[model samples]
Target: MLIGELAEQAGTSTRMLRYYEAHGLVRPERTANGYRCYDEAELRVVREIRGLLAVGLGLDDIRPFVACLRAGNPSGDACPDSVAVLRRKLAEVDDYIDQLGAVRRQLQTQLAHAITVRPR
Candidate 1:
């Protein structure tokens, strides 16, 4: 398939695919006329990149996963580097959740005080 077809099938924009290529995440060959040419396997790779981005992973963090897929793994997270990234991301999310929980407690305490003092 071509770049446009890969973008359409992967539910992403051609511009993003090109961006991925520029960032060294996705590498497509060039045709004789200089048009970009993609392999069918690239569809899976593009989808993997999109999923990682959606979850707040930057291109740098996604590199290992892409490399894992390119190395013939069925899943991007199959490699050790990919697993390390996932573990780090999970820890970050946990910290964020903890911060949100603290904020929620503060808000609830304020609401209770306001309700008690301003009864109407």
Candidate 2:
């Protein structure tokens, strides 16, 4: 399919698809007329890329994971490096969640205090 169709099927914009290509995430074939054509596999990769991005993984960090998937790694866990990457990402997510929780607590306290304060 063409870029627009692929984007629609992947729940993304053509601009994002182009950005993914630019980032070396997805590589679609070029038609003789110079139009980009995406296969089902590429579509799947695009979906995976979107999912990774949604989870806060930078494109650079996702490269190895994507490569492992493309290389037909049956277990996905077979790649020790990918496992390490996942662990690192998990740690970062945990830290971010902790920080966000602290921010939420601080906001709640400030809001409670504000409700008790008299307006001048």
Candidate number of the best TM-score: 1
What tens-digit string does per-residue lDDT give for candidate 1 at 1-120?
788898999999999999999999988989999989999778889999999999999999999999999999999999999999999999999999999999999999999999899966
Tell me the TM-score of each prediction against the true structure: 0.96, 0.76
Off by over 4 Å in 2: 74-78, 99-120
Tens digits of per-residue lDDT for model 2, 1-120: 999999999999999999999989899999999999999888878887888788788888778767877888753335777788789999998998999999999999999999999598
lDDT of 1: 0.94
**Among these predicted structures, which one has the highest lDDT?**
1
Q: At residue 103, what lDDT does model 1 achieve?
A: 100
